[model samples]
Target: MKFSYKAIDDVGTVVAGTLEAENREAVYLALAERGLLPTEVASGESFLRGYLQRLELALERIRPVDLIFFTKQFRTLFKAGIAVVEALRILEFQTQNGKLKRVVAQMGEEISAGGSLGDAFASHPSVFSPLYISMIRAGEASGSLAGVLERLVYIMDHEHRIKARINSAMQYPKIVVGALVAAFLFLLSFVVPAFASIFAGANLTLPLPTRMAMALHAILLQWWMVSLPLILLLLAGVYWYQQTPAGRLRRDRLFLALPIMGPVFCKAAMSRFASIFAILQMSGIGVLDSMRIISDSIGNSAISHEFDKIGDKLREGRGISDPLRSAKYFTPMVINMVAVGEESGRLEEMLQDISDHYDDEVEYEVGRMTELLGPLLIVALAAVVGFFALAIFMPMWDMVQTVG
Candidate 1:
């Protein structure tokens, strides 16, 4: 349940914000924890308004760059001794994204209402991730919100650059594959049909490749009405399945097992895990809590599940490195470095090293994938063009010989 509450803070300024709680008592307790005196608490939102908010959130997408800029500017402002609410108000005005601006304004209002910074961020889960909220909560508790935002800006910027590099490497292959499909479709739809009609007029035996090409052309021309819907249904089913838990697990596993791209993804996930874990630890978050938070931050479900197991073992009083040895995705080097970090009392430094190591590895693997895939794509393209050429010209050569 959500409640809108009016409160008076230490200086007796009135503040108001919405909070999720089981009852008014919970709301009162939460406000008290924040050192606020609650005057009034009202429960629930109108169904239509709630529906509109949900729709708005679904439509509003916040990009990484937006978050990076927000955090960087926020850290600079807060470090300059501006009050949190004042800094947020500045951001609310300075933000370029209309949706982000609204979110910033709402956050400022929440803070003005005597809500904690973490709570304000939590209210917008689409804009703030679990890792972000947890770190902010830790920062609030430690009185290091500005520092935390600095680290967040760094992490978000690094992640964006990594993704950018990977996407740049993939752009060529994507364009090549798309072109191949377009050319093949055009050949089947127009060129092949014309040649197929000519072969039909000749009434001569066609080679197997020619026959296969002509059959594909026939399907494109005659069966498209039936085929289009089935193709769409198959794609939709695939998307739905991938969204399911078991299907996501299998799909992520398959991603890690892929030949050229697997190591890039694996290294990227490891880099993210180490980076987030290090920052969370540095921010005064406990090891177990960091593990739980990092698990959700990792993009791969298979790796995330392993982190869950590691968290379970941490609950059993085992150290982080020991259980990591048993995880399939944790490289031997990572396990050894973690073990050393545990013994040396330099876990944060070690985690940073691990993150840096994997960051380099991800870069190298992406470059290697580009190199390997370039030749492979060329070979595949050659084979496709050669096959189509043979399929079309073989019949022409045969006709020429017959006429001679």
Candidate 2:
């Protein structure tokens, strides 16, 4: 546990700080050992604990892999007949990440102090998500926490795979763009200037393209003086805009509505929703609650808003397929499958199929798009370079012919 402490030293100097320790008594003893008299020692169970809890909660938002590993390890240990508190204690020592280690230690202490596994995880809500907590609660209620942990691992692994594919798909384009930008800067700053110097002394009347190239080169040289502030202002504007809910919504909508990427984005979002819903269903969470949790997990405001309406419809006892069909973001085929699932009482199975199907579709589309982008970008670069070369040399060719 962590505590905030204020202590007076032997020479009457006061010191205040926070530290992680075993308990309040241990904290006081440690201070006394340092020749300090504790004037005020705030326990980890106080307001400071609440603050740490909030920080832990935020960290949890980004640590899906960590959660998966923890769950998987805990389950493995549990199945081997290791006690829960003992397993957590071993995990605390085994973890290399300081924050995770600290968290595991805290959990171990909590459980050892008679807190239930779910309650221990609940205390660090930042690390364990609603889906995680819900599934654990179900497992506890059903007396199958080990099984639930295994399922959680599978779900997390699936999510990781999807994220990896997206990253892989984007990597080529990112590299291409980065290379293009570097090459452009090199030419404008060095190559173009060298050519410009040579042409300057040639006393030739340059052609239109050559003149345009020279103008561009000059502007680039001068641009930083104007461009720097403009860029900073643009960044500031973007930051300010994103800070506003409306602005963020508008930005998200724009991203989803992009011509080439909209379909891919929508498919990815749908895939996530389907996969999360399937996991929730399998974990014994109800349909409406599952939808709400899945919506929160999707991470897009526009899609989440539509999901909210779907939840409302579900609350009114309408079929899941009805609101999903009305949303129009999902394809007709998807809606049909969902309808079939609803009718067959196998929504989880159908959702898993949907997730698998779209994941493949997304992967294929991303690969195709990446393959198409490479040649298109290369052609554009060649055209720009060719135009500049022809423009500049044409004047030189005319000059050489006259001299000959």
Candidate 3:
């Protein structure tokens, strides 16, 4: 049966939402399953009409930085001895994003109604990651939600720093490459045509490069209608391909194999895994569960596949280090560190150390990529311009020398 329900939040605030169930008792069980206490449940098609309306909230995406802020704010509020419901209410009222505010209020209602905070957050997977939900569950089970929040805040802030650094490094090269392509196209399409006409009027014997450039300019000027549509179609096809599962897998494979940048992504993925694994371990989650979470946290299917293999090996009773060593992407140093951690029963600490080390490695690689790409782009730009100049100016120089 479909039911329209009214529930109370963690902060004693009333929340009205809808649910699908077998009966009124099932509705209550479902609510309780989510850590909610239903204040009112009404059956029939009356509530189902509003289901679509409730389904479409503000639709705002929750950003990483916003999540970090939320975690820190919650930690502070919880540490101050404020109840979860009240804390959520305050955040819901104060939050700038309409979507997040509504979500926070919904979670507050669920939690207040006796639902777990983790389950409430889990309901909105688009806004909350599996790692975030898992950590919350671990914290709730261990009765150390505040401590988990603190660690989550730290991990998020650390991730933010690393991401910002990589983005900053990548942004400059992207801009340079884009600019180069634009200038090259502009020169070839417009500027070359004008020069070609001048050379044609003079009836000068053009060099092979100038002849080829003029020929290309002629084709662009005459048949751009066909070329433009063809180009657009090709680009659209490529984009559509990229959006497909097979295409995404191929793209990621190429990205991971790319020189300089590939290693950085690999290191960053491993670092995220280690960071999450450490948090899960410290929060008292088991090794098997921790490894499962690590797969989702990494964000790369190639790496996730390797983790899945490792997971299967563990399920077969093999230890962590041995399974991990088989992953081609795992550096020898990381494998050694995990082996050491296993021996000392300090795997969490070792994982944390590995995370920190990779963070440094990612930073160093970003800097190196920047240093290497700058000169390479400059040389490329110079080469292209030099070629155009030789093509356009070579005939002129020959004529002037002949006149002298």
Q: Largest lDDT belongs to which candidate? A: 1
- Model 2 lDDT tens row, 371-397: 777787788777766776786678779
- Is 1 or 3 the stronger prediction by TM-score? 1
Residue-wise lDDT of candidate 3 within 198-245, one digit each (tens)?
Answer: 777776788988987887778888899999999999999999998887
* Superposed model 2: Cα runs more than 4 Å off: 1-8, 15-64
How far is each candidate from the true structure, as Cα RMSD in Å? 11.9, 7.5, 11.4
| Candidate 2, residue 241: how far the Cα is off, in Å | 3.3
Question: Which stretches in model 3 have alpha-carbon errors above 4 Å?
Answer: 1-60, 402-404
**Is 1 or 2 the stronger prediction by TM-score?**
1
Higher-lDDT candidate among 1 and 2? 1
Instruction: List the candidate numbers ranked by TM-score, top first.
Output: 1, 3, 2
Ten contiguous residues minimizing lDDT sum, candidate 1? 42-51
Output the TM-score of candidate 3: 0.82
After TM-score superposition, the amount by which residue 382's alpha carbon in candidate 2 deviates from its true location, in angstroms, is 2.5
Give lDDT per model, in order: 0.88, 0.81, 0.85
Superior by lDDT: candidate 2 or candidate 3: 3
Alpha-carbon error at 399 in model 1, in Å? 0.9
